[model samples]
Target: MPIRYFIKQWLMPPGLLLLLLLGAWWLRKRRPRLALACFVAGLGGFWLMSLPLVVEQVARQLETEPPLSVQAWSGLAGRADAIVVLGAGRERGDLAWGGQDQPTGTALERMRFAAQLAKASGLPVLTSGGLHYGTPPSEARLMADRLRDDFGVVVKWQEEGSRTTWENAQMSAAVLQPLGIRRVVVVTQAWHMQRSRWSFEQAGFEVVPGPVGFLGQDHGRPFAGLLPDNRAIWQSGQLLNEVAGLVGYRLFY
Candidate 1:
């Protein structure tokens, strides 16, 4: 795995929280007061992550782009030259589809939305992603396959060597810009769209943000989302990662 992946896993929540709890256990007798502080921080962090309301609030601040209206779907061609679907990730393999790698739920969400936009506007589609752990059948190819087989929408281009959002924009630019395609509609999660749009714009494209899978809306859970849910932890992690990516891209890219 990449060193950056390790750094992120250790520095970000859940992993970081785990470390704090471990520290608390190690220091329980040696430094009682410090250990209690660590324990409280670690447990409190997990509790906040497990609350849906916390996810909703953080997501509200991150998901700046609004969903496109249904009526506007068919008119995408007038606003852009093509649709670009940024891959989230891919499932390694499963026996259900004869052990072939499949797009993850996040990637499928992007493909589904891209298919709708493609069918409505008749614009060409480009899928951008890289290999799965440096292996064959890149994410771009997986999404392209699903789009064709499941959605009946063909992908005109597959830039299949991007591992980061910045790479997605830069690699897609290398493919589309040469063909005189400069304007594109970028399809990605709502919280992810801001960084994606910034990267694509930096790569010299006229971007139309096509965001989907918003998480900021009401959860309608018991106690108004005060209740803890395991899924909320994952949602909170995703939103936090987006915030890190937004800052990282501005710093490094």
Candidate 2:
């Protein structure tokens, strides 16, 4: 895994912010003069950069749902060769166990959505993910088990040895090609759909983005919409990472 990925996954935005705040406080106390100004500026910049209002507004605009003609998610779901659920959130049980194998949060949501789409369309479902940090079962296996037990759906498992979005596409393509799969309905969070679609397309797969859990235009007060959210800041960083990865993939892969 890349160093950047490690930082983003392990440190998290809030953790990193806390670290920065601590470092700034130390500098302010120690130097008490020139360094204090620098530390204060850095702290101010961090706050401004992470301000929820700015990030959320930009994300809302940039991550808008694809047009009906392009998305046509329901229509595409009906025609897809496979419903591919990309991993994200984790299940509560998984978190409690500290096992990477379980589906948490958005991961469960993606699986459920994919299962529904598969059941409705009669398309096979492909769950992707691998052993993250020595988890007992890979994410794929966990999601597959849920499909079988909860939905009575038999899904094909793509236990990809991937730890990132790029790997997910690359490994999934390798696994799906042999099964004569051409097009897939890719399921993931709304903020993640565009980059996921772009990566899969770059990997030579025809993808119809099936986005869920979007963070845009919710029923909230005007202040809520403008308020700075730490989650939004983290999401923006993830999006920026994806955009960078896309550019790198286009140039190198």
Candidate 3:
């Protein structure tokens, strides 16, 4: 726990902020010089982080055309292993009802993709997630229900009690092992596939990467995409976090 806390702090933006604040205070005797120095340093740090570039490069490396058209997944209707969907975000639900009715975010995207995959492959789906906050049904349960009601796809649930990637791998593997599910078609955002694949493989699952929602290319207006957008920063943060996690998993897990 201590190590985890240490790593978390070390990886966040606030840690850099604190360093800048302290350096600025130390140079307070020379106010103008200090102000200029701090401004330059802040910009330097942001540039050094280079999140947008990192995200773009990673995305470029992993990007693929949408796999198995609707008809293809529908064709696989009975022979493939489970379509495993990973969780990413959560939504607020009615507190009085114990989160049972809260809308979920990325879980929905995962399910949508899983449904397509299930239709193409004719395989039952496996949804993996746990409640990290509030009182809602576990993400896996909510996803399973969505699969049944919305797509008519049968699903198996792996309610991972993990709040991080490593835990997700460990918990999901445990659930799949009992059912002899060794090979899985993993569905998640393209940006996340590298880390997800690594973690699952480390956990002894044979993963067939089925990435979705790519961020690198713009098919219609190519010029507009050349300029970086706000999402670039977010993507960069995700990439750094995944790299850090991979290192941490090796060192500690």
Candidate 4:
């Protein structure tokens, strides 16, 4: 794993909470008051992460991009030059596909939406992502293959050297700028649209947000909506990461 990944995991949720719990255990008797404080803070953080409302609120803030109707999708080509499906990740070789790399679930979600947008608009597409953990098959390759094979849409551009959102925009610019494709229909998850839009705009594309997989929702059950759920924990983690990225992007860029 990368050092940055480790640093992020340790500094963020679960890991940080675990460290607090360990501190509380080690100093329970030696420092009773401090131990109690650590225990409370650790458990409190965990509880907050486990709630669906927490995920909803964080995602809602960043998912400011409005949804595009099917009617509007077909009209995109009139306003936008092409479709840009931002790569999420690859599933790394799986036994089901005979050990071939496949698009991750998140990647598939983006592909599914992009497929519709492309089919409706009849526009060329671009898939952006790079290698993972130093692996060969780039994320762009995986997305391109899936888009062609599964969706029957040819990807005109494959940006295979970008690892971050910032790089995605910068590297995509290298491929798109020369072609005079400045107006793009940017596709990604609704929660990530903010940073994605900022990065793409910085790269000089007039962004037409095509946000999919909205996260904010009401679970319908009172306890299930607010209680400790494993899925909510993951959503919370993703939302927290996006929030951090937004702040970092604003500060640095």
| Pairs clashing within candidate 3 | 73-119, 73-120, 73-121, 74-119, 74-120, 76-121, 76-122, 77-121, 77-122, 93-102
- The worst-scoring run of ten residues by lDDT in candidate 4 lies at 216-225
Q: Which candidate wins on TM-score? A: 1
TM-score of each: 0.98, 0.76, 0.75, 0.96
State model 2's lDDT. 0.69
The count of residue-pair clashes in candidate 2 stands at 11
Which segments of model 2 are wrong by more than 4 Å?
A: 1-12, 29-52, 61-74, 89-101, 226-252
Clashing pairs in 1: none
Write the residue-wise lDDT of candidate 3 on 205-243 in tens digits: 887777777765543434444444466655656666666
**lDDT tens per residue, model 2, 145-234:** 878887788986665576667778889988887788879888887777777888888778888778876655554635754555666666
TM-score head-to-head 1 vs 4, winner: 1
User: What is the C-alpha local distance difference test score of each model?
Assistant: 0.95, 0.69, 0.68, 0.90
Model 3 scores a TM of: 0.75
Candidate No. with top lDDT = 1
Per residue, candidate 4 scores C-alpha lDDT tens digits across 1-253 of: 4998899898888889999999999999999999999999999999999888888777788889989987798899888998888888777779899989888899999999999999988989999999987897999999999899998999998999999999999998899989999999999999999999999999899999999999875656467577678988888888888998999999998
Residue 226 CA error for candidate 1 (Å)? 0.5
RMSD of candidate 3 to true structure, Å: 4.2
Q: How many residue pairs clash in each candidate?
A: 0, 11, 10, 0
Q: Alpha-carbon error at 250 in model 4, in Å?
A: 1.2
